[model samples]
Target: MSGQVRNTTKIVFIGAGSAAFGVSFFQDLFATDELAGSTLTLVDTDPAALDRMAGLARVLNAATDRNLVIEHTTDRRAALDGAGFVINSVAIDRNRLWQLDFEIPKKHGVRHTLGENGGPGGLFFTLRTLPLIFDFARDVAELCPDALFINFSNPESRIVLALAKHTDVKVLGLCHGIFLARWFVCQILGRAEAEVEVAGAGLNHFQWLTHVREAATGRDLYPELRTREKAHDPAFTPLTRRLFHSFGLWPTCSDDHMGEYLPYGWEGGEHGFDFAGDDKNREYLKTLIDDVASGAKPVPDDWLKPSWGERAVAVIGGVLHNRHRYIESGIVCNRGAIPNLPPDLAVEVPLLVDAGGVHPVSLGPLPDAIAKLLHVQASVQQLAVEAAVHASKEIALQALLIDPVITSTDAAVALLDELWEINRPFIRPCV
Candidate 1:
């Protein structure tokens, strides 16, 4: 389970001001013995938010048995010094800008249901955020060149692509989509989630389950999965069923998210997530900030139990402890992982993470049909990366026009105009 365990390791969180993610990540750090005694550096833009989360991290560290070193700063460079793993989940006005990421495309006559990771919205989201992300990556490249640069931001594939292409840092974009594939198989088979082994590959939100087998017997379960979907498909996953019916392989993630890539996504799909809960969660974090700053509410004792998913934490542990582990799916440059897709394009595929670092595992080739569907997205994402880094409106327009959803040239121009004027402040001349 171990290759090289560092006597002292540093894990820095880029967006520790995010309450839900910060809280859950704190829980994960406490739960992992592999990272015990390592220092945690928290970075964020908001000072008061930093003050609040710093208090919570201290409270959690005191309650835990591990000798966790906790520090907070708005200066990312100050935090990146000698970091082993740089975990990033920073968002620029998440709920508010996410609303813009969704609605702006719809205004341009794009029939998109979910704009988070597909359509023009995803492109714009990548454009706005990568500037900030690349800034962090540049510092990491200079300060902690060997650190595993991990991103938990949205439009995971595009972000990884931008960093991969623009920065010297090799990045890995981790998403929960890979786990959903296993859950989908288990649900179809009427088995416990732990009983199903699934292999999936595609874009981040648009991955497909290529293999499903029973864990104990190594029996193929795709036939039975098809049979169940034919008899009674779940309404909750209509888009997945639709793609599976056409392409003959179940896709990972939910209908709304999968709907983002398809042209007819708006017919019976959602445009974006109901961030009402997210909004409430942000407000709750605000309250917690006040409570922590005012010394009323302390860090919850139950976080010691750590009930959140272990995707990011596992990668953190794998590198820091040299515990080579197989991650179900992580986004990285193709490097021939999928022969059908471009070698330079970032794709979500399984990988073995260890002392050698996060290596992209070969997943053979996707069916021509699936490859064709993802290729368009790969192009749009690449163009978006170019547009963001170079500040090219022409490139951004080309990306939107190339996007399957925004086919009309006139519409693309009009849409970009509106989106540009609206997000002018944040986008800041980054076309």
Candidate 2:
């Protein structure tokens, strides 16, 4: 892999302070041999957080012998110049704000499963997030126009659509949901995850698996998957099982994410993300980082191992080496890629990556029944993107009213008024 790259590249991470993503990203980056000697810049708003990640990166860099030229700063503009790749995972006040996003809607009688990626909550997230991301893209366009923008942000579909419609930053959204789905399929079949192959495409979290087969023989496995899924525990992934039964296409991801799109999502769970558990995990990770970075503990072997689901480093390596690699899944604009969906809508599908760019592999047309379900989301997403880009509260209201998860116009109005105020400090025109 190192032999394939002819020149060193500069890579930038816009929100590199995150405990989970920062460490995981460094792990993948250090494990890739081809990326050695590349200049890696970490940018974040929080100076202390940035310093901690920098310390960890230094420890990893020394341990792995990757010879990476590491840099850290709070100023993204200073870091963006001459960068070949920009990876962003910025979530403004992530947990605190998301809690409000869920609670406010529920208080207004809107029962949502996970408010991060759908419903009125998703609308507000779009409002708050799109402006900041567009600002980052704007800087990239001015400083390093050729850099590939890889995003790991939530409200994945909305962020991709907004960037595609309003900016020219050459963006792609990545998520591990598809891998989770593959694991789910393998679980039902009682086989190792490596033994089965699954392909799905739709919205980011709400993708439908169209092909399920044995990787060894390319044998169709969906029929047997259905049989085993029925006989298996009814308690596991109940929403996904029901959807697979009704639509004949298995949905990837679990209940919380898939439930975001439907009005009946409360059937999965009315409670939102587990902030308490997440807080605990965040603290544990911080301690681990402190210990490892300060030489109080030895580096974990797993930290130096290659990650299976993360595709950012794989993409960088592919583009640098001009390797036309087949990526399992990525988010990009749908220009007849799905045929039935709107041409401008952003859809998640397989990708082919090379020096030219990231190209969305056309899944052709989805099943009619499935397409029907996605059509509504397409409209809602379109409106939400418009609302966010223009900073139009009226359009935001319309987006919420049209959403399937938003049952009552009155509740939509109340939820919007409350959430819009809560996110007012972050909301702005992306243009």
- The collision pairs in model 1 are 113-271, 114-271
lDDT of 1 by residue, 1-431 (tens): 47854566888898888888777787887776777788989988898778778887787777777778888999889899999889999887777777876876676667887678888878778777877887788889899999888899888888888777767886999887767767766777788987888888888888888889888899999888878767675674676777888989888787777778877777547546778987887897779756764668765566776644448788877865678899888999887998999988989998898878898888789999999989878888888888888767788888888888886788788878877676666564322
TM-scores vs. true structure, each candidate: 0.93, 0.98
Collision count of model 2 = 0
C-alpha lDDT of candidate 2 relative to the true structure: 0.90
lDDT of 2 by residue, 32-146 (tens): 7878899999999999889889999999999999999999999899999999999999999999999999999889889898799999888988999999999998999999999
What C-alpha lDDT values do all the predictions have?
Answer: 0.80, 0.90
Superposed by TM-score, candidate 2 places the C-alpha of residue 15 at a distance from the truth, in angstroms, of 0.5
Model 1 score (lDDT) = 0.80
